[model samples]
Target: MALTPGVLHVTQPVDGGVGAYVAMAAADQARRGWRVAVACPGTGPLAAELDRLGVHRLDWTARRAPGLSDAVQAARLRRIVGEFGPDVVHLHSSKAGLAGRAALRGRVPTLFQPHGWSWLAARGVAAAAALAWERLAARWADRVICVGAGEAALARRHGVPGDLVVVRNGVDLRRFRPAGPRERAEARARHGIAEDTPLAVCVGRVTRQKGQDLLLAAWERVAARDGRARLAVVGDGPLLRALRSRAVPGVHFAGAVADVRSWYAAADVVVLPSRWEGLPLTALEAMATGRPVVACAVSGLTELVTGGVGALVPPGDGAGLAEALLVRLGQPALAAAEGVAAAALADGFGVDGALDGLAGHTLGVVAGVGTGAGEACSSSRLRKTPDERGFDEHCQTPWGQ
Candidate 1:
């Protein structure tokens, strides 16, 4: 009889996209009857959701940034790994990726997923250091799972070597679906938004990377052009207070909400002016909810927001950002048409497919199989039956090899 495979997911940011991804993956693994455990801080939505799902959780208190405590953090992680005895270790985001690899040191099958390359978020000496760390740490990872093709490309461009695979991020289609007129009206009423007001929703952590400041700068122009337009900046972060202090007219800071779907439903268009990303969950969720997106032309955003479905302005181009939002807000028919196309595109990125692809890779790694260097495998190519414990003979060669 085959023993149930065990997976341990270690993560640091336990609130935004990374946290949500961990929660979804852990829950899915548990439902499949695998022994799944998550090592994360005992706070935020990740911990709360894991507890609700009845998955075992170990308190792994770690900060978002590396510091003197990282050595201690790695030691604690090593101890947790010893106790859990997982068949595979999956580290999420940069902080966990850093500590997990250092702790395990390739002693076990390990997967490192940098939701976004840490170097992209750093500057000067910090950026160089981050890139160097990633290049060095690649040897510790059996497989580096990238959330999108752009992420994998970035790694190769920066000479970060590893067996890389792109598993495009997916959204919960059931939870975020197209909002009809009645549904839209109800969502607006629920959020206290006027039915007639032009609304553009931005959902993400209010940090430099997420670019709430860029959005606010663009909103100034958007408001100047159209006084009736309203923008809601959702989610909370360290920059929330600083951003709110600017006091841009017709802008509402919703803070952090338990549910972001209603905000998507209440929007004429969804906007993301992020400086960088690796297939942001906000863009996927908004598209799945049938809303047009006006985002900067960054890595992940460029792939998701095509010409027909939405507009992509160059990163930090405030005038272009404002123009894109204004075009969508002023032309409801065009926005609605683009939204229908957006929903159609989002159908191809269901959460089930993404999770299944991840499971296939996990099982493959446990069985001592690795995908070819820099290969991007989709769920369709990597799908396995529920009863399957590991890769079959056909899956041994890696997709497209």
Candidate 2:
């Protein structure tokens, strides 16, 4: 008799992209008849979604940043692991990656997903320490699942040695489809915006990583050029109040909303001036809604946003960012054409495919452990699903293979 496969997903962030990813993965695995449990904060979107799905949730008390309480958190995680007895453990984001890996120490088949590298969010001495920790922690992770090729490239470039696999972020195409004219008009009306308004929507947590501040700075140039242009900064975070205080005219701070689809539909263009990303879900959602994107030429954004779909200016270039937005907002015909192209490109990246690929990798890792082969599974053996076949250069074989 074989035991049922079990997976435990641990994450610190209970909202935003990381939280959403965990919820989706847990729900998918549970529906497949696998024993799946998510250990995360009891509040936020992740918790709410898990509750709605009737998936098991274990309350995990952890902070968003490294602190003295990490050891305590790790101990709690160890207890959870011992009690649940999962076949595999998946840690999402930096804080969970840190504590979970530290607790398990390769004792279990652990998958660490950085979401976005921690070092990218740090500065000066903190950045160096974060990078060093990642390199040392690589030994504990059976596989470092990067959400994008650029994220995997960053790991290799920074010498974070381990089995690196890329499973690009995906969107639910059913929920996010191209908005027709009537839908657009209705969305605009619901948002209390005029149908003819040249709106550029930015949807993400209001943080330095998301670069909402940079987008606001660029919006000055945009507003100066076209006073009729409107910019809506959706979502909320620690910097929300500060950003709102400094917001210029025509810039609306929506804080946070239950649904972002209406915002995408209402916009002529979507903007993401993120400082770093491991393939942001907001960008994918926007593209799936048939909205052109104007984003920073950063790792994940560069991989998705092409000239035909939208514009990618050099990161931190305010003038360039402003110019990109101007081009789209000024020409409705061009933006519409690019949006069509964006939706076409986004068609290739569906949530089902991404989840299926991840499922394949998880099963492969478990099989390797069962065979006492550790992480030394062959590429052919791992590529069981059709989605896994499209991983391209993003997935690599184990070292010494």
Candidate 3:
């Protein structure tokens, strides 16, 4: 059989990294003459985002615990697969992975991308139950596609032993480049921030894994020194209400900005203090946009934030986190130098690179394609921190166990 248009069914809401990946894949696949469509819990800004892209939508974000949601979604998607006749079903996030994989049931090839699993993110709130749920989801998978090795390892830890492909979260460098002077000034003006204020920005949902709570705490610590250090947060999540109340004296929450370029342009220092991650898109975006990043040195983050391109701090260390931010904010020349280093670093993760890697991986998963080789070696083998040691590259992680 010849490979053609590939369809991916996502059960999670259309938002965040998974959404971006689907869009890129859809556009690239369309250009390559593949019929691509995404059926998701198209509600809220994410649904609106999908509409802008002219994607196929589905009304099915019904609450699905590992047991109930999985059964309902799987049954519904089984019908969808039969009707749509897709080459493969690509599942995004944990919920979608279990549902989509189980629904397809080998009738068609299924690709599961655990874009941060529920177990890793859901702490103290029945986490063991989530893991149990994932073990069940893995049963229906053809090829498990992990966003990063950390995620892949987590999958393995939970008994998902099989052929796994790790297609990392990537960024489009062309759109997110270093700011030219005119554009930089205009962006600063739009934000009503002075170029001299030393802006710090964090882009992602205000959720637990994103560690906005930690960022808020760190913000207070940083502001205790340079009150001029302004914090500009981008993105919204379930934690928006509590995030709004954070009110770090020098921090400004921009809510969810459609065009985040202005914020990226205005920022001299960028931070992603996530408690856990698969492979964060924000760190790549910040590096791609030519900003100095200060991210936690763990998981997939250790893979990126290498060299002298960015700074890294251990996760959950509030004082260490504050010190890392302050060090960069205090030195304009050094921050600019790091930004330039980041610009050099950004060239590695082009959209073309991602597509070349992703398209093959994706199509193969759908069409039963294979490299006929074992899984790729993980960067975790390299024991080093993110700094002058050549670990401070593009910092992040999104999906987890």
Candidate 4:
């Protein structure tokens, strides 16, 4: 009998976007009759999701950041790869991209998705080292898949070379349909938000990268104009306590909730002030719930939040962020119109296309085709990053153009 095709996804930080991405991919691959396995710390919501999906799990004692223990972890991952016999190894985020590549060393067809480049998150010596490693590690990947065009462009800008392909992040649409008034009222009541108040919900970790502080600063201006407008910062992180303490009137920290859809249902508008992203799921999820978004005009948001579907302000620009939020929150009619457009845009980003694209890419790599860098989806559109903002590009645009 022919050996079954298998793929192994490896990552650290088993609670955030990276973890969620891996879980979704592994489950989809498994459901399609591929032998899929995931190797991570395996001790959080993602682990539980993987268990539910029936994807083989390997315990990897990997740290969020690089440490001396990387060698040991790499060895463990190598053993798992050997045991699982994956034809393709898909590494998610920096931690897995590093250790998985180190373990495999081009012995297998490996695909690396940075999620967001690590150099963007570090500084000084650490940043320099990350850039250097990324440049060197390009040789290890059969293909480098980016979740957003900005991620691919940023990699090139930093001299991190690879066969880059963009596969925009997607969400499950069935679970996130537009909320009716009854659903909205229940969600708002659960969160202590008044049904009639203009509410902006931000769903993400309370971290510097997520720009919660920027949102808080912007919220001051928003509240100054509309006293009834409320801001809910959902998700937990290291900065949670500090952010909660500094929050003034009209700001509520919901911490982490199991079902974030309820929060989306409660919102008049959704916002993300991220400094960078590989197409944040918060914006996608909110759009799926038929809500307009006000997000920093960086990375992935540039592509997804175009036209009147939502508004995008410059990164780190609190005043601009505030203005965008005010436009969405202060004008209910405008927000409602944008919400309709948002739902239309989100209709193009259901999980099926993304899952199919990833599967195609993996199969092509395993078949010895270089990079598997073709268009992931015919419907996927491309948008320029801030530096090249006015440029019109299509999804068919070749890399390095």
Give the alpha carbon lDDT tens digit for every residue of 182-290 in model 4.
8889988987877678899899988888999999988898888889888988999889999898888989888888889999999999999998888787888999999
lDDT of each: 0.88, 0.86, 0.72, 0.82
Clashing pairs in 1: none
After superposition, candidate 1 runs with Cα above 4 Å error: 1-3, 373-375, 379-401
Alpha-carbon runs more than 4 Å astray in model 3: 64-70, 157-159, 374-401
* Winning model by TM-score: 1
lDDT for predicted candidate 1 compared with the true structure: 0.88
Write candidate 1's Cα lDDT for 243-335 as tens digits: 999957899999999999899999999999999999899998999889999999888887788768899999999999999999999999999
Model 1: how far is 268 from its true place, Å? 0.2
What is the C-alpha lDDT profile of model 3 across 1-401, one tens digit per residue?
34685576575646666667766666677677776777776565656766777666666664534555567777877776776777877777777776776566666777777777778767675887777777776657777766666666566656756666666666787789987567778889998988678888999878888898998888888888887888888888888788788677777888877778888888878898988787887888888888888888767676678778777788888888888888888887898888888877767666675666667776667656654433332122233332212212222332221
Task: Summarize candidate 2's per-residue lDDT along 1-401 as a digit string, tens digits.
Answer: 11457999999998899988998899998988899999998988888999999999998989997889999999999999999998999999999999999999999989888999999999999999999999999999887777876777778778888888777778999999999799999999998999889999999999999999999999999999899999999998999999999999999998788889999999999999999998899998999999999999888787788769999899999999999999999999999999999998888778897888688778867776321223222221221332233333344444213
Cα-based TM-score, every candidate: 0.94, 0.92, 0.88, 0.93
How far does residue 303 in candidate 3 sit from its true spot (Å)? 1.4
Task: Show model 2 residue runs off by greater than 4 Å.
Answer: 1-3, 369-401
